[model samples]
Target: MLVLSRRAGESVVIGEDVTITVLEVRGDVIRIGIDAPRSVAVHRAELLEQLETVNREAASPSEDAVQSLSAALRSRPGNHAG
Candidate 1:
């Protein structure tokens, strides 16, 4: 990690388009603002981890579990499109 000291209103730029600016500081808490293009994605670490786990689960489903789900769906009253 590249560590730098910055006061409120100071900013750091990334690449050619992204800028992270310090907005406020109160004792141990600090607030920051990010400026990036609309196509860029910014996510908190924990939320990103949860999204990765969900994506992994979606990509690799168990065969037996899939069959069970298919059976249950087929048995539903209005599900006759099989």
Candidate 2:
């Protein structure tokens, strides 16, 4: 892990396009601003973790769930199930 101490208004650059700047410091909480191109994605760690968990769950469906979904879709109007 890279560790650096920066005051408000100070910034660190990554490669040629990304910049992480410290915006404010209030006691123990620090606010930061990031500058990156639209192609880049930035997400809070917890949110990213949650998304990963949801993706994993969706990827692996239980047999009961698959059966329930299949039944529901097959029961729809104008739909046929084999």
Candidate 3:
């Protein structure tokens, strides 16, 4: 990991589109601001991990199976009428 020292209000550029700036520093926590295009997604590390897990679960074939089962239920006799 690359680490750089930045004071409050200092900023670092990421790639060509994202900027991370130090907004405030308290005793143990530091607040930061990020500027990026709307198309870019930003999340905390833990939240990103959770989102990745959820996305993987959603993209798995089991989810497709579940959807198929739901469709089958809706198509069963007495479940819907033409």
Candidate 4:
């Protein structure tokens, strides 16, 4: 990990297009701003972990399980007898 010091309104550039800036500092809390292209995704550590967990769960589904779910939904009777 590369460490650098930045003051409020100062920024650091990552790669070619990404920029991270120090927006505010209050005692121990520091607020940061990021600028990146739409194609790039940025998330907090906890949120990223949640997304990874969801993706792992999605990728581990069995084909038969998915087909069974589809069949169950299709077989459900709809109420149209009003």
Per-candidate Cα lDDT values, in order, are: 0.95, 0.96, 0.92, 0.93
Query: Candidate 4: lDDT of 61?
Result: 92
Model 2 lDDT per residue over 1-82, tens place? 9999999999999989999999999999999999999999999999999999999999999999999998899899988657
Off by over 4 Å in 2: 70-82
Q: Candidate 2, residue 63: CA error in Å?
A: 3.7
Candidate 1 lDDT over 1-82, as tens digits, reads: 9999999999999999999999999999999999999999988899999999999999989999899999998999987685
Residue pairs with clashing backbones, model 3 = none
What C-alpha lDDT, on a 0 to 100 scale, does residue 55 get in candidate 3? 95
Misplaced by over 4 Å in model 3 are 52-82
lDDT of the structure predicted as candidate 2: 0.96
Quote the RMSD, in angstroms, for model 3. Answer: 5.2
Candidate with more favorable, higher lDDT: 2 or 3:
2
Per-model TM-score on C-alpha atoms: 0.66, 0.74, 0.60, 0.62
Could you tell me which residue pairs clash in candidate 1? none
Candidate 4 has its poorest 10 consecutive residues by lDDT at 73-82
- The most accurate candidate by TM-score is 2
Number of backbone-clashing residue pairs for each candidate, in the order shown:
0, 0, 0, 0
What is the per-residue lDDT of model 3 for residues 1-82, given as tens digits with 9 covering 90 to 100? Answer: 9999999999999999999999999998999999999999887999989989999987876967989988888899887545
